[model samples]
Target: MVLCHDEIDAVNDMQNLVAAPSLRVTTVQQSSHTTLLLCSAYNFYPQQIQMTWLQNGEEVTSDVISTDVLSDGNIYYQIHSYLEHKPKPGEQISCMVEHVSLSEPLVQVWDPHPPRPLTERVKIAVGTFFLVVGLTALVVGIIKNKKRTAALCTVMHENLVAAPSLRVTTVQQSSHTTLLLCSAYNFYPQQIQMTWLQNGEEVTSDVISTDVLSDGNMYYQIHSYLEHKPKPGEQISCMVEHVSLSEPLVQVWVYFHCFDTGGVLLRVNIGALYLQSKVYRIGQLYMISKHSHEQSERGEGVEVVQNEPFEDPEHGEGQFTEKRIYLNNKLPSWARAVVPRIFYVTEKAWNYYPYTITEYTCSFLPKFSIHIETKYEDNKGTNDHIFGSEPREEETEVCVVDIAYDEVPERHYKESEDLRHFKSKKTERGLLPEGWMDTQDPIMCSYKLVTVKFEVWGLQTRVEQFVHKVIRDVLLLGHRQAFAWIDEWIDMTMEEVREYERATQEATNQKIGSFPPAISITETALPINVRNGPNSAPSTPLSTEAPDFLSVPKERPRKKSAPETLTLPDPGRRDSIFKLPSFFSWNSSPQPE
Candidate 1:
């Protein structure tokens, strides 16, 4: 530990030195004719510094761009200066940095010269060898295995899957309709197929499929949508057929509910019959009706719903979709390899947009990460009156609720400009909330209570943006089959808590490191020593008995009782046996007396 401490201190001291500017000259692949010289100085303390690029001992100010001084989070600063040049043989490039902490200015140089003859010879020889081998292998391969390659291509054409992952998400724009989306991603070849089935029968009409999109890294994704009134026990599935799969991948979802109440209103309760081992966000489920199990079991015909334009004087819920900027996943892979990644890297960049999007069901997406909850609700004060039929004159009010630790957010939510991050709070009695005082379903009596959980790990602070984006993602991602995956709900995991703490600590350290040092250091504690008073007995003798605790119970006294006498029998015989038991002899003698 001591050694580690010393090493850390030594590192800090060394990093505090005036950094020596280093230069790297390299060719730009984008501009084949020009070379770029990069000069960097890092880990220098005392913020004021001077940096300049030099060409042949003369300052080269043109075609040079230098970055603003940036702190490396310890009061030390770093800067990168770039110079683009068309270099000739024997040309030189250098950078100079001047700082008050330095005894002298530091200069670093990069010499650009053509490769040595030996190196040129090695490159030519390797190229020639590879060319000869390639020609020979090409001729042999063509002559020997053309037929085999053709057969494999045929097989692959029939079974290859472009996408490896799938997910479905749903959002309710209104209590009347739920949008279901089917997403497939992490692809190889783009040859793919998709279909939707209701109660095992393929629904042809009202189903829309998207053109396959490429991430440019050889992966592809596509979406499919189905608009219809849901029935219970209705086995809704998105069947994807890919060349790499021998059998089509079929993901089934059933959202069914029944009525068990005999009250004034027919209270409908939703039953989930989805058997697939998949996870769905808890928020999107709110916008759905309980599947009519009896209706589906009896092979009832489902009502086909069409995609009505929300802005068409018809609905306000669909207006949220206008702000959605979709999956722009066409980015290059970090790996120089050919295999595509499971999750799209470009997806994170898409999130930087002002709008938030929900993946109603991107079938293969590992998780749904949105910052909103979606649900169908019985219109509370207005009548149409009070439910999913007609919109009232009032502008649609959408509530973005926080599901505190995956629970309903009826309480402890901060609302600013219509955004909310649900926080867990103690009850009036100061205990963890166990009942539904505030946690009750927002759309209670409307149907099922649905909340869409977002992957809002770092978004708690951005209330307005978080809330708006959440509402947008839900509208865009929700389709007919999007809400099929059963959610695996849990609170904060130990690993997650630890990771959060670790990140917070790092951020705090970085912030603290960038500040100026303390001008006046305070002592850790007051340093005053006192001599003990003369060791002597007290003036009065100390009481020996221990103090009694008023609240503690005292031992009860035992009740005294007389001991009972036991009579023995007399000897059955004078010499061999007792005449009677002692009790009989004692009683008989007493009677005689």
Candidate 2:
């Protein structure tokens, strides 16, 4: 039975309701002149709290900064308050807190807690616990369906704490020799074994094993090395054994041997759906290795030109920003001739791409300022009223093919309304006072996924835009189809791509359903057809040159270049295979032994 609010609060009061926030005051030596005191209160519940500072028993106000109450969603909140002062000898400083459930504000005098322990000393337990849990669940459910439960348990074990995932990295050391390197991490239960296996048998000699390394998260991983020049048609594998699995985990690496195809350059345009309420700004481009798991990736955050000044969008309309980035190492000149470029204009969120959100890459919020003052129209005469100056030719991005725009409605409950409604129930029970309610705000959540599909040369390119905030947006994270298309684009030619794109374009047209193509094309000079406004050219891609086919290059190659962005597979520096949520497993099952 559900307990009444008064009954729950009464029970909570007897149990002290929530833990009083524990306070720690630490000092950071900013310089020879002043020291900064950090006041942190954590492990508290029912977040309504007031923390204050005092210098020598008098309430201190200036130079004080406190974080907003941050909730862990279990009715618990963690917060920090900071103060900066010149440490005058014999001046006592302290931090005080008042909670709804506390009788007296617990005062903690200034005592510096020891510096946070370095990560190297912490021992973490990895997949071992979850694997055992799954095994237990499998046993408990065995009577219901033994085969299916065991299979599910095995899959869980593989996903939770599979043996150290082995990544085989090979670079052509020379025309005659290659550096065959195998790196593994994201594992658990430290007693892991790694070895090089050729064909099917283990190769003991000519192998190097490093001591197990700690990520300090309780997970241990180590790298095993083998340096050798290979014979043709030979199969190599990095096999690992750990306690998480029913059997050893093996990752077989077939050499990208005797390359018949030219080296490829991949360009990705990076932007987030959350940036819709802004002026049209250019996106970032990065030079990444097209081959999966290549080391040495770097971001080149080059800003492309902006378009004509526009006004705020009308209701039910959205603003779309197009960013084109190149993904590949510098290619041989011949590779440029047949560069298999991929363009996706679907409205997927930023978190979907693995390589996009890494620490070494640009992960946090979008770059441009939050400015929304643009309204675009197609008639040439309308520009004088919108822009103080005439629009420049360089700012225009000519889509030399058919264009189509569609709106996908993403329906979600208005979150603020949900939260407010929840708070009102508590307020009625005298939990939170009536002052927290704002009766004026209108509740809304109906949003549209703005999409634009067009062809660039023969590539079926689409651009999708939808606004999102953190937690709600994270639920929409998806990338399989997009990345797969990215991979497939590596093997395509312009003419062949166009043929395939024609089919997909036709399919999309069918889905538009009774709506005439939002875009129309005609063979005319300098005439722009923009049913939607605020469109412009993309910034120059880092690696691939414009094909000189459909679209014109946005800019000439810059003389000065941003240094190369490298991909670090070092476990200490990456999320690796464990980037998935705790229980989600990738379909990376090892081949049967």
Q: Which candidate should be chosen as best, given TM-score against the real structure? A: 2
**lDDT per residue (tens digit) for residues 1-593 in model 1:** 12333357777786546554333343332235655566767666665778877767876554454545655535456666655567767766777888776678788776565355567789899999999999999999898977765655433344444545765544322222333557777776877888887876888865556566554344677777665556533556778888767888876543422221110111221112121111112212211111111111111111111111121122111211101111213212422132233222111101101111212211122222221112223322122222233433222222211221121222212231111222222211111132222233222322211212222122211321223323322221221112221121123333343333234323333332332221111112112232111122122212122224211123421111111111111112111100111000000000000
| Reference-based TM-score of each model | 0.24, 0.25
Question: Which stretches of model 1 miss by more than 4 angstroms?
Answer: 1-163, 256-465, 468-593
| TM value for model 1 | 0.24
Predict model 1's lDDT versus the native: 0.35
- How close to the true structure is residue 561 of candidate 2, measured as C-alpha lDDT? 10
